[model samples]
Target: MLGRVLEEIEVNVLASQAWELYRTLQLAKFIGEELPNVIEKIDVIQGDGGVGTILNIIFPPGTPGFSSYKEKFTKVDDKKRVKETEVVEGGYLDFGFSLFRVRLEIIEKGEESCITGSTIEYEVKEDAAAATNANASSMVSIQPLVMIMEAASNYLMNLKNNKNKM
Candidate 1:
């Protein structure tokens, strides 16, 4: 069966700033510097940080299930602040998923606020459907990513707030 999930979160940051973080390779830098607890490191395996870019998203040592996965950037749209990534190997596939993909979009709501939306698409192998469905709720967890984004946003906001104080 095919499964699709969509979730959105609002952050207190300018749309342009949020778009830049989402569209370019700066996000890797942010995560590495600001969220070392959640994301160990984001290594670019191939291509530039754009369409066709491959990334190894490594989790911390004690992270559950698997350590990392290779994801290919399928689409990158700066104008719309959208990024699409597909799991090429490891991670979810290691858990027996036939196919899996994720899309992230930053929608501008105002001058200082934006909504980050995530869409997950997956297809399960018929044989693994039963087991997959049973543990599905906890299977595909984006909690870490969400946390990282929130922390990054807060960090940027703090920088702005602190600068204003000066």
Candidate 2:
């Protein structure tokens, strides 16, 4: 079975400003610091923040049946303000999912505003028994992505507001 989920949030900042953070490893660091409950830690396994970079993302302990996953940056396009990462080890793959990928895009809305869109694509092993296949499909959710988007939006908005006060 194949599945996908998408979520987007408008950020009160220039697309370039948002891209500056999204296109680098700083986003992972921000998540670790700002949303430790969602992600406990992120270790760079290889490469820089660009394409081919690999990250070991560890979920907080006690996160039902999930511990960590290794994901590789398959695509990072600064010109288009888009980035993509694929889970190459563990993670949803351990839950009978054959593939899991995430894509994030920043779309300009106005001179000082933009939208951050996140997408998750996954495929379950077809040969898996019916029960496993069913369980894998149920595991796909956009809630986590939604939380990230919300946090990013709030962070960016606060940043812009603070600058305006200066």
Candidate 3:
């Protein structure tokens, strides 16, 4: 059986009195389609709830995972955008070498969104080893999404601020 460990982090950002920008920008399509600096396109969206969306990506210097390729979103759902999005994601990485299961919850707080997120990552082994070691699958997971989240947050607030000023 595979074992699991947990990690969670919450980030709160204050924009110009509107949290929609922050919440909406977190969506997968908006970043790859609307944002100017997106690395690639969003091809597959997994999971029934808003918690999962996958983007076909190119290798960048800071991309996460055991390989240069990565899945753009591991999990995303902010209540500020749609009022409430609750879901959990569980999957394995390339083989028994790595695995992950994450849960993300977003709460709106008057111009700010309280994002409470948790994830469990561990080494996968046994029968799953060979299957995961193959070429990148159509379904992928983006690991270490901290930087993307930060950029999206900045873009959200700044874009709104610019629009309002004009």
Best by the lDDT measure:
2
Provide the global lDDT of candidate 1 against the true structure: 0.82
Q: List model 1 lDDT by residue over 62-91, tens digit each.
A: 987889999999999888888999999998
TM-score of predicted structure 3:
0.44
Ranking by TM-score: 2, 1, 3
Instruction: Indicate the TM-score of model 1.
Output: 0.87
Task: Name the lDDT value of residue 43 in candidate 2.
Answer: 98
lDDT of each: 0.82, 0.89, 0.41
* Local lDDT at 139 for model 2: 78
Q: Candidate 3, which ten residues in sequence have the lowest lDDT sum?
A: 82-91
Q: Give the backbone clash total of model 2.
A: 0
Alpha carbon deviation, residue 65, candidate 3 (Å): 5.2
Question: How close is each model in CA RMSD to the real structure?
Answer: 2.1, 1.3, 7.6
lDDT of 2 by residue, 43-84 (tens): 999988999999999999898767999999999999999999
State the lDDT at 30 in candidate 1. Answer: 84
- TM-score versus the correct structure, for each prediction: 0.87, 0.95, 0.44
The residue-by-residue lDDT of candidate 3 on 1-166, one tens digit each, is: 4443333334444432223443332455555655434354444545433334443443334534432233434444343332222122222343434444433334444455445333333445555655555433223343334445555556655765787799
